[model samples]
Target: MNSLKRIMVGLDLSEMDETLIRYTAFLCSISEIERVYFIHAEKSLDIPDEVLESMPNGMPADEKLRASLIEKVESYFGPDSRVQVDVQVVEGSPLKELLHWSKVKQIDLILAGRKFHMRGSGVLAQKLLRTGRVSVLFVPENIEPRLNHIVVSVDFSEYSLMALDRILDSALTRPEVRITCMHAYEVPTGYITLGISYEDFDERMKGFARNKFAQVLERFPELNDRATLHLVKQENEDDIGELVMVEAKRLKADMLVIGAKGKSAAALFVLGSVTEKILRYNDDVPMIVYKKENEEIGFLDALLGND
Candidate 1:
């Protein structure tokens, strides 16, 4: 579990983007966040002819836009602030610029606002999860910046283990935090398609789930004393994503954490089907999508090879 020291927030100058900045401010008040960077990436370096003509001779359009965006971001924090704030305006696609900044600044966490209904924004969000290395926090509209109850989606994979580690690390620092480790299992569709007994099939799946849960408890003994485990069984007719959301709501979870496996040749980027689907339907709950540390090695590791 790594505590965030530096955070890079994506700023799109939208209403939801303000929510992200406000959420970051809340973290600064509660945690040990030392620095914040609000970055906006402009797609083109070239300014519109109308705007360029209005500016004084020899004045660069990019510089002027950067100054304006910085001022707008600064107003969110006001004059007095404990955390150091930096405003950046870069020219390129949002995904590329944000990814490069995260690596260069060694950002521990990346924050951005999300509205699932917006297709363009949704695409950019997926790009961040797929391509970016830093852990991402997608804050929905009207999210409280509080983590009273957290639901962590697990599947016993190393990616889920990484998510569990980060969630537990944060939970340890906060007393009386309610943590639920949720594992959703599904029955094979072939059983239902072939008209097999639903009850018998369900029972067999439950037996396997029980054994898996036991193994999970053994791997994370801390949960025995600190957290509760929730087992979910999904039949062929049930949507895994909907089931996850329902369980989280039943527990009244304030946040959800899940792991993302980085890009592979076949899939490009893998956060698993369930995790991505949950992201699609999510509206208000703040979700943290953490990537495995060793999955995509940096330049140094690539150079070193298997030593």
Candidate 2:
């Protein structure tokens, strides 16, 4: 949000790797990203013995692969890149290497491409989403690198508020861009067991949800001028994540931004239940996952606290 100064983009040799680079380029063109680290994590350093035998005896297999990958990525950007590009090649699990590099280098954002057909890539992405410390932007294949409209999912919780704040603080929510602050709500299933008619409960729940949405908007008065508020009511069999995707499609949003509720049991229920499902859905819309920070209590507060 604070104009990402450093970004690390994860790349594989697959065709989608270029898509990640182009996405990074698109962001850099619009924001203040200063340095871009393009990284490829090779699963192993070992090469086939037959191929190794053909190469010079003194050459290292890892070094050869590194040089080749660097050249290939460089070809995509050529020499006239608007931002500083640094190509890096390493050997390890992709998730592990990406997490380590981002943390050690103080990366502000991470960019990666999602392959619809690759189940393994999806698993790796989920692992990164859970384990990585930095914000990640997952760009699906064939997505246009534009930011005309963005949908930020909100539950009126601190974590969702954090996501909205990040988008507002950035240049992404400019005047030309249409921003939608969307919240999805559903009545408790127990209402049916308690003899409440579904229709009766739904109407009551929707009224409550509308009031909550109004309260949330009241807190951010400027949003009234810059964004639109949308409240979605979930049906009996609807999942929250599915509802979010349906809203995105209905709104024709170019991007989706949502916050992870951190690892606390209560927080996990919010992010893990919905955001995790959305990640698996892979609807071809780009998404930014913002993780909530661990709020550290002050010394004065700690001393006076009663748990």
lDDT per residue for candidate 1 within 1-307, as digits (tens), equals 3467888998775666667777888777767777898888889868776865634556576766667666666766777887899987788878778877887788878887777554245466667776656789888867767767788898878889878877666422365667788888777767878777878887787777677767777887867666777889876787787888888888898888999767653565555576688887787788899986555555323322333
Clashing pairs in 1: none
| Model 1 spans with C-alpha error above 4 angstroms | 49-60, 75-80, 117-120, 171-173, 188-222, 269-272, 297-307
Global Cα lDDT for candidate 1:
0.75
Score candidate 2 by lDDT. Answer: 0.75
Report lDDT (Cα) of residue 54, candidate 2: 38
At residue 90, give the lDDT of candidate 1: 84
Per-residue alpha-carbon lDDT of candidate 2 for residues 1-307, written as tens digits (9 for 90 to 100): 3656888988776777767777777787777777889888888878676765634466687666556666766765668877788888788888778877876677877887777764345456666676555688888977879999999998888888888887776666767888888878777888978899988988787787677767767877767776777878877787777778878988998999998754533342244467788876756899999875432223212322324
C-alpha RMSD of candidate 1: 4.7
- Can you list the residue pairs that collide in candidate 2? none
Candidate 2 regions with alpha-carbon error over 4 angstroms: 1-3, 49-60, 75-80, 118-120, 189-221, 264-272, 294-307
